[model samples]
Target: GAGVSQTPSNKVTEKGKYVELRCDPISGHTALYWYRQSLGQGPEFLIYFQGTGAADDSGLPNDRFFAVRPEGSVSTLKIQRTERGDSAVYLCASSLSGLLADTQYFGPGTRLTVL
Candidate 1:
């Protein structure tokens, strides 16, 4: 009955570098999502997966960002060419379905700091 969890809670990276942030979803949940939250802003959906396929990825900003959920349970967000603007809380959430109204339980997030 573990809830969604993210590692490293904080990360500091140099510009133009690459980073990977991980997420572990709740048991038995087949839906997982990744979102980025900037200061004082709402979480912007990045990608969502149902089972092993990415059901929605339109929210990803550009090619520099990517995510995967190979096992349908744990997910990882990868960023290439890190920029100062990419510094934010990378949150992970999970729900029972990919439906619009499903309540997503979020993790504390890995705060990526770009220097």
Candidate 2:
């Protein structure tokens, strides 16, 4: 793949509902990251993956938020009992490696709305 791709560009759901956001990263990239951006705020790192394991998941708010990269290429973020505050744009990025300074290219974010 040339770049990251995210599905369901826009999502709407009730506050208690669950949602799954998908991301397909660039081919051969060894690192993938997930971020959540609230209105007027910069993206906050939610999780990072190197290969098939989650390298860092400290940014996830709580048990309600979970993510997985089963095969090191495609990843899914699952949200349980979504709240109104969870409404934001979910962004996915990938790089040749997950270095702090490496250029991280992003995909068009999936805008989530919790009513």
Candidate 3:
């Protein structure tokens, strides 16, 4: 895909269940990010990966939320022991090298509903 692509446009899961959101970044993009957006709020950074290692993950709310980019092209956000508060739109973004001048391309987020 020319742009970032996320899997499962919407997800409905019961409270306490686990969920995984996938993202496929554009070809040649070495930087990938995961974010979460609640209702009436802007996206909040959750994690950022440069290549296969996490460059920054200070935005993650808690220990339950984790993201990984094993191959540096595909990334996944994993939520363990989900709660109702965890419901939000999971956004994925990618850039050339995570440089200051790089432009981030975002994917259509996956809306997660916890009930």
TM-score order, best first, reads 3, 2, 1
- Estimate the TM-score of every prediction: 0.96, 0.96, 0.97
Q: What's the lDDT for candidate 1?
A: 0.93
Best model per lDDT: 2
Candidate 2 local Cα displacement, residue 3, angstroms = 1.5
Q: After superposition, how far is residue 81 of candidate 3 from its true place, in Å?
A: 0.4
lDDT of 1 by residue, 67-101 (tens): 99887889999999999999999999999876889
Specify the highest-TM-score model's number: 3
Which sections of candidate 1 miss by over 4 Å? Answer: none
C-alpha positional error of residue 36 in candidate 1 after TM-score superposition, expressed in Å: 0.5
Output candidate 2 Cα RMSD: 1.0
Candidate 1, TM-score vs. the true structure?
Answer: 0.96
Which 10-residue window of candidate 3 scores lowest in summed lDDT?
1-10
Candidate 3's residue-wise lDDT over 37-103, tens digit each?
Answer: 9999999999999999999999999999988888778999999999999999999999999998689
Tens-place lDDT per residue, model 2, 8-100, is 899999999999999999898899999999999999999999999999999999999999999889999999999999999999999898878
Say which prediction, candidate 2 or candidate 3, comes out ahead on TM-score.
Answer: 3
Query: How well does model 2 score by local distance difference test?
Result: 0.95
Worst 10 residues of 2 by lDDT: 95-104
Flag the better candidate by lDDT, 1 or 2: 2
